[model samples]
Target: MNTAHSLAPSQVSNKARVLLPGARLGLLGGGQLGRMTALAARAMGYRIWTLDPQPDCPCAQVADHQLQASFADDAAARELARACDVVAYEFENVDLRLAQTIEQHGYLPQGSHLLAVTQQRLREKHAVAAAGVPVTAFRAVRTRRDLAAALAELGLPCVLKTTRGGYDGKGQWLLRSTADAARVPDAVFHGDAAVEPAGESDTALEAPLVAEAFVPFVAEVSVVVARTAQGDVVSFPPAENVHQDGILRFSIVPARLPQEVLRRAQKAAERVAVALDAVGLLAVEMFVTADGRVWFNELAPRPHNSGHYTQDACSTSQFEQFVRALCGLRLASPRLLSPVVMANILGEHLPAVMRHLPAWPGDAKLHLYGKAEAKPGRKMGHVNVLAPRLEEALELLRTLQVWGPLDLPAPRLSS
Candidate 1:
């Protein structure tokens, strides 16, 4: 593994200069991550500009300027970069080439190499495994023959996922039987769901599918690590995550695990950050088996939903840490000030959430994304409930009763 300490002084010297207060910061995505990052940047006395397809995007509401455009618009990306001192992206799905283009016009502290590796699952898995992190067995499925071979090797109860443009449970399917395997088309396996057809650049679609063996783990956990341009690294405590229908439903901080397990998870996360030469935030998700084995599950090279508890529970929120890292500021301690539980508010829960809005206690901090419309399975907002004890926070979340009947079946937990 290539450690940050092994880099040459010249390589470190070439990094973008430290962006100070009053400088304008450009963000690539105007979703919740960008919105929160903008909020933090504004609080630090920096002007913010954002580019997103939605004119009324959440981040746009707080930004000094909003450039409404598609992620693939190279001209708009350059315009955003030219208008700001340094640029950062809140999501990983932004076009990798667009980021490279932005770098030519202005400083992109986070760099584009990590984004290129993370946008596709096949590449991401390979990167992680190459970094000496243990990952579940997986094979790239570019054709029906590949899928069949992977299935034969990995067996039933495995998962088939699109290599790119998948999040919050989109673009993946479970294969539990031969019938499930027979339903997938060869074209779907090879075509990228995120790429525009015959675009300005003839971007060939990479491997579009991946098949992985399913591990029946006791719990899912994640650690959010932030790295500065100077190679300083800091990470928050591991968060125990629970997902329902492939969407993260809740994150319990100070994950219920042995101290040894937590330490291992943290170390693995830090190693990933250093190996990727990550300059901003990177959230590493892992699975812990009943026997205490940890396996890499996924990687998000930006603010993560699992880290939402930090907004209310930590002295420095993840968004602030992200800004600090990008601007080359000293990283703050990611201490857990209090035990907390964060529950995602999906679109299905909005009605009940609004009806009980005034009933929530001060301990519960509600963050709505300011989206115009609510659809099934859409992440409309989240609520972080803090308490002196983890059990109390969990109880409060359970009794909140905001979430209605889900469209899909209840999430299956490991025995």
Candidate 2:
């Protein structure tokens, strides 16, 4: 592990500087992102402390210490601040008042303001639009009258989402006709069949909502940008993503698109990071049209699932870039080491995936979260398949077919 530089003028009794290695880093959320980030920080000779309600969460399993408490626990929040030199967030669902307490300590570089913007659909879209990035047509809906008006304005085949919370396709409704828009403002209910998916699990059922024009986009892509407080930014390779039921199914590197589309997507993502004046890592999700124009979709200010392939296929992994960016170290080169296809392993599919693991290819890298039990639709782990040719990687992935979207299917072993 490279120290690079040491803490300034070490005190005889006590010394701590978040800028250098050997300092304790407190992670706010303890899912797989925290788990991976902690692993990276530990490899760099830094201590890890995770704060999450789950005592045995994936991140806590690897952390040096764990603060087992809800995000609403102020005492635990302060304890984390006092114990660690710096704090970084692994997720965006931190409580509002608790964020105020943590921000008072000055360790949170990407403050509550960023959270406030991303937590709400309307504000996020406005910020992206203000950054001169193109976004789909949208309108705010408050009452039943407002819902009717928005549907009339944006038309059917639009999406109605809660302004706050709701992630990974939950807490949203796709209205294709007057019937879908019938009950609104007072309450919006959905059948299991009517639910649209999102990237996270924040279903803010009671919060206000926003309506957006449904885009007939050909592909969805994301770029993970790492920026320091000094404005230095490095955007990772744009990944073509596939989502079903509102959850990411897989992320394909060297996206099967024209070179011009890839270049513009990366540039557009960087522009949004600059526009938001973001520090740390920001994953920018965008919709790329057939004509090569890029449209902003959403932002996740943390290590994103879309960039998971970087761990096995990039010169510098997103986790390492995360630590470097937060600690003010020089950014690493975002070069692709090989073509990769990262596929998510959901809970229901874990058994089949494990059964075939013994036959996996030499270059296939598997990462499983330390989750106790597997539930339907829960993200358990992911595998990254790397090959000399991108097509070869895709073919290799196809052979392991427990996971599937429209193009990919379940694989069966030869008898």
- Candidate that would win on TM-score: 1
lDDT of 2 by residue, 93-201 (tens): 6775566677776476666666766766777888889988899998877666777888899887998887766778877778899787885434542222222322333
Candidate 2: residue 407 lDDT (0-100): 76
Local distance difference test, each candidate: 0.85, 0.79
Model 1: which residue pairs collide? Answer: none
User: In model 2, where is the ten-residue run with the lowest total lDDT?
Assistant: 1-10
Off by over 4 Å in 1: 1-13, 196-205, 404-415
What TM value does model 1 have? 0.93
Candidate 2 all-Cα RMSD: 7.6
In candidate 1, position 52 carries an lDDT of: 98
**Runs of candidate 2 exceeding 4 Å displacement:** 1-18, 183-207, 404-415
| Per-candidate TM-score against the hidden true structure | 0.93, 0.88
Error of 1 at 335 (Å): 0.9
Tens-place lDDT digits, model 1, residues 1-415: 1112334555453584788999999999999999999999999999999999998999999999999999989999999999999899999888887898987888998888888877878777877888899999998888888888999999888899988788987888899987898997656765656542221321333577889998888888899998888887889999988898999998987788877778888889888888888889999999988777789988998999999999999998999999999998888888789999898988898998998889888888999999989998998999999999988887777667785432222123344
